[model samples]
Target: MRFSVPLAALLGAGLSEAQYLISEMSFGYAGRISSADNPGVIPNFVVSGQPTKPEILSSKVILTPVAPGNARGAIWSEQPLKHPNFIVDVDFRASGPDRAGGNFNIWLANHGKDIGAKSVYSAGRFEGLVLVVDSHGGQGGMLRGFLNDGSVDYSQHHSVDQLAFGHCQYSYRNLGRPSQIKMRQTSTSFRVQIDGKTCFETDRVSLPTGYDVGVTASTPDNPDSFEIFKLVVMSDTSSHDASSNSGDNNNNNNNNNNNNNNNNGNSNNGNSNGGSNMLYKKQSSSGDESFVDLADEEADVFQTSKSQFQDLHNRLQGTNHQLSSVYRSVSRHHQMDEQRHNEIKDLLAALQSKVELLDEISSFRQRIVALENEVRNMNNELHKKLQDNERSVQGALRVHHNSLTQRVAESVPGHGKLIAVIIGTQVILVVGYVLYKRRRANSPKKYL
Candidate 1:
């Protein structure tokens, strides 16, 4: 009896069919990479612009530092992706001032001419796809896709926004966490996802083999930081292999014709099912030959499991590194919060001291008011006593004057003159005493 095991069953048995990983096919795009993490090995992407490449720790790479001025941030894959149908997962973060015009780009295209005249990220005559996540002044992330076939100069192109085929806006900046950008390319269509949710897809988009990957960032005068924690590219090559084998010559002709197409002509007008998240159509199996190909590729289940375990280990290690980073971030934020709390505490203490000083000032004012009231009472009493004394003296003088007048009438006129002199002297003494009391009451007094 002939052994008839279905390829689907083999896949179910953990034997991945024609799908290749990145590391497994690095040379000439044949790497069947199972994972992106290599404990000590640097990643396969070369950083652009910077002559000195940074070490890839835990698959994280820094494209540019957050600084003012329109600094270019870019990174390119070392190998050109040969698989036509592939999936790319990009985890990144962009942060800066609220008004920072921060943005980063994901590009897929053939090798471009190396020159500063062209964005250090792309070539002067480049052909491929670009997905731009722009932070519209920190309002949110504007996801826009562009298809270019290198005829026009992108450097001087003013109205690139008009060339966008599909776009969606979402808040993906300053999230305190990373946002994922997922892109899938198939023979018939291309698709993009943000945070596992499909944003847009286009059937009109077609990418040939031998396309490389790249990322770039840009910021305004108020610089924004764009960081990439991970970039994982994987592929489902069964359909691509089938199509490539069907007609080698036809594909070459198509590639040439498509390459010559204008970049602006790529419009997803009705080609994309916006917000639908529908998957692309897969190529149907051509018959018994598919089984034969799958049969020839059969391998030991034990080795497959062993390879999977290693990939799992690598993934765990990478996860540990990411966790460590998150821990550090959390710790830093905690420190900042503690510092802010202490500052607030100090401010409160100062405010309390100020309140106490104001209370003392208010008490002092009340005491001064009380003293002024007491002095006014004393002056009033003194004035009353002086009034009483003046009344008694006036009575006595009146009585004495009457007596003198009577005596003068009864005795002599000379006695009358003497009584008048005595009355004048008493009036002068009373006037002097009243003036002295008024001067003492009006003068300033120091109680303390």
Candidate 2:
């Protein structure tokens, strides 16, 4: 719950002395209120509005409205503001059913528990400042600042109509995300920030003392509500007068300690001085006291200077040794870096060779694909030529067969009669030749 301010930020802003922690409240210390609990009986927080007690679930102070109608509720801190200049950090969640009509307020008011009716808007006569989270109408989720001068009668109605002093829009209702608001208030200035962004700031505002810091919310005819996780109020301790006083106290303490050490050193010196005085008294009887005193003072000065020189020499030798060690370490690191660089270079060369080999393989594959395409084109041409030649030969064979059949039919009027005549002629020729051959054979028997 405690927040720390950055030292650098303070110094850079010339506010090095302005950093201090005043108060922090996590709301976690409060006990959980169950259904059986009474709202009016809760300690440290004054709850008003609705019939049910505001529940503190999971360490969060929840202000949920009662169901069935417009409802409002508020929880006010029992402790009053202790510092006029302070910062307030609040971690809260404001959500409900989508587009719910409601708003949440963080009030720094002179009035304690009865600031208003606690329904959808503030009620009752009040003084001091109010930071309103209005999540309704066209300007939904608007963050507005209101200062009640006790002139307007809040009891007449619950609307914060003409009471707004300044306004800024911020989307927090039903956002399903937690929102943070930081307010830094000084004697002459008032500032408000939402989620680290400055939403409103002005110098025309002032808040009196004895004001209570509290939270309130109102839901109108819906399940709209808000919960506060943590609230921290830090008092600014950087006032000029406080810083001067603190500095003076520190200086006084330092002076006192130094005086004590000086007194101890002077006591030791007194012993030496007493010894010198005894020597002086002895030398005075011999008329040599003044010269002895001068010589003793010179010796003491020389001894002090010698001791300082020796210390300086020892420090220089240590520095030289440290430097030598650092140089050796740096050289070793450099050698290691060189070796790694060489290894990386060799790896890069290997990767380059692999890339070149892949490129060559890709080119060879492309050549093979081209050659295959060429062979396919040649094969297709040869097949087309073979088919043309086969068709021509078939046509020629058919013509020749037809011509021979026509010639035979024309030369022999009837194929069967021609065949029989041809057969009879061949038989007569064969018989005549045989008869002649037999006569010759008989006549040839008389002649050798």
Candidate 3:
């Protein structure tokens, strides 16, 4: 029996290859996932409560307590999952100074947009799955899974019986080494592995659509710390076994043609109906048959070559896209650096102007000091001149008083009563003679 397979079917089979990368986040880059704005890039995480905002430190996302009290925080991805069958791989390190005891949760929840303070603790009713690595309250290194059906509300306390669907224990904390956690989920099964060891698996799994992934951490009294080195999400494509089946069928058809040719009698027909037609010919008595099936082989080779080329093209395109994203990020950083440099230049210019003003102020102060000293010297000289003038006037007054006293003493020096009377008579006679001479002089002047 001969079989015919459609070329469209073969091509369709080749097109349905499996395994696609969705998103990858390596905190080593300068742009933070929590602050990314590009749609292709991871968006900034929204943090609630007093937990420290996720920070990129030492090329890792460091999640620590913002304060020393009962500090708890949650950070959720802003983007929703694109596929139902997906895998999440994370590289992380957990450590503390004292005994390692804290709770770390990884949530794939439908309420990503509504994630708030209670999301981490399973406080309110939530719909999705939670994978917990708990090392608190003597339950050290406990790994567990919880599924919320959205029918029942979560209690105030997350009891194991109330919250957990399945659980296992592993020594994850204080290992002094980094650990990798991987989770794969499909329509029928969900599995979790820690450091390449299977921690939990369940066949009865159901996750809702439009789920978002997140991480939350809390510590009571210990100084617990969590650092995420890398995080990636990948999507699984539909099965690609159709291409293999088609190839096998083609091989079987070729084998059948060979067998039929061996059984036939000798043939010699030179008629050609293009390369796609199979030709069979028989001779009279040679008992030999000839067959040509070139088109089938050529078609298989061409299909394979086309598929390879398509795959290579896809990989190159992905690589180019990644390179372009990196280039944009680097360019943005460069522009920011240039802006900072300009601002620093302006600041330096401002400081220089202030220094010049200070210098001018200092010169003015020196001149003022010189003027004050000159005024002080003038005041001292004026005071000294006033003192000298007062002394000269006092000396002149004393000399005048001394001269008058000497004259009075000399005039009264020789006689007592007799000298006084003789002086009086001489004075009286001189007065009379002076009066008579004045009277005669007056009378002669009148006659004249």
Candidate 4:
């Protein structure tokens, strides 16, 4: 038991915190054995039987061997299971050539109870629940569930058939591979899955805490190999003890004290109205076949309200599940949004670099425009200075000509003819200078 607690502690320490469960169950185990002859010790487990002890092999536990009649054996947890949310995965095999009479069972009953080949391969009457895989009818195996509160013995009355809550047909015999049975229970529901498919589920059933989990097999006549390959238990919580175990302890002690309580007691007439709780599925014969909810109570006024309450509770649980899914989706979207934002930041950095390059080009074009304006201003100033120089030279030549004419008139008699020749030469020079200026102005000006 201490070893089992540490295994749960190890699981909790290595994993992140669970949302629903804070404390883990203390009754988890993995099956193991060292050899065929030697019955190896598995932690948190005990083996008990009526005939010889069951053989514990390295890979499987043989509850019943071939050709064994009136043989019975059971392997069960050593401690009470206190955790409410748990999963049990059982890998088992039934190898019988034909209809060899035998049955296998798993139980959650009072602590320290010795379970043997009894009712449905378990005790015919128990204080808790029994799940059965019956192969004794010579047909495909039938998986059934039952409940009792320490009363009504099906073994004595042979009334297990009438008392069954629900069952489904499963051909588990002669399968080459191990058939897997997964029982998953949460706070609001209990579901059974066989061979990776859901077999049955109930949201109204509530199993009390502090009960032991067990596996047993029986052979009334004929031979069969009912072997358990593995038993695995898991929970979604940290390892912690149940706080209200005192109440469970009292109940377990009472059941132990009354060990001789005849499972055949006829006080409730094959049913318990007070302490024993049995589940019944709605049948087509009953108009209220829709009423598949189970309690110890028979169809009466008290059961109606209880069933209604359970239905409301189931609805609330559904709403909670939907909310959890939405939350997970939102978290994923948030992560994606952050990734996209980072990508956009990088893209913006690249665009910013290109904008800076374009700004540099614009600056270069502005400088070229300023240089062109300066060249145009220089060409205009040069043209104005050339015009002024030409005007001054013309004025000096005219003044010189007038002075020469006056001297010639005073010194010689032919002044009139000399003046006329000089006037004609001046007119020809002015005409040639004006034509050259017009030609230069008409040509295109080359900027420096």
Supply every candidate's count of residue pairs whose N, Cα or C atoms clash at under 3 angstroms: 9, 3, 8, 2
Between candidates 2 and 3, the one scoring higher on TM-score is 2
Off by over 4 Å in 4: 1-31, 34-39, 121-124, 136-139, 240-448
lDDT score of model 4?
0.64
Across residues 158-239, which tens digit of lDDT does each residue of candidate 3 receive? 4645567777777676678778888898878989998888888888885755788777766666557776666666665311
Compute each candidate's TM-score over C-alphas. Answer: 0.45, 0.47, 0.44, 0.47
Give the distance in Å from residue 284's predicted Cα in candidate 2 to where it truly belongs. 58
lDDT per residue for candidate 4 within 99-124, as digits (tens), equals 57677888877853655445452365
- Candidate 2 at 290: error in angstroms? 48
Winner on lDDT between 1 and 3 is 1
Each prediction's RMSD to truth: 26.8, 23.4, 25.1, 30.9
Mark the 10 consecutive residues where model 2 has the least summed lDDT: 280-289
Worst 10 residues of 3 by lDDT: 265-274
In terms of TM-score, how similar is model 2 to the real structure? 0.47
Candidate 1 accuracy as lDDT: 0.61
Off by over 4 Å in 3: 1-18, 24-44, 47-51, 66-69, 117-122, 136-139, 238-448
Clashing residue pairs found in predicted model 3: 34-44, 265-288, 266-282, 266-283, 266-288, 267-281, 267-282, 267-283
Q: 108, model 1: CA deviation in Å?
A: 0.6
Ranking by lDDT: 4, 2, 1, 3
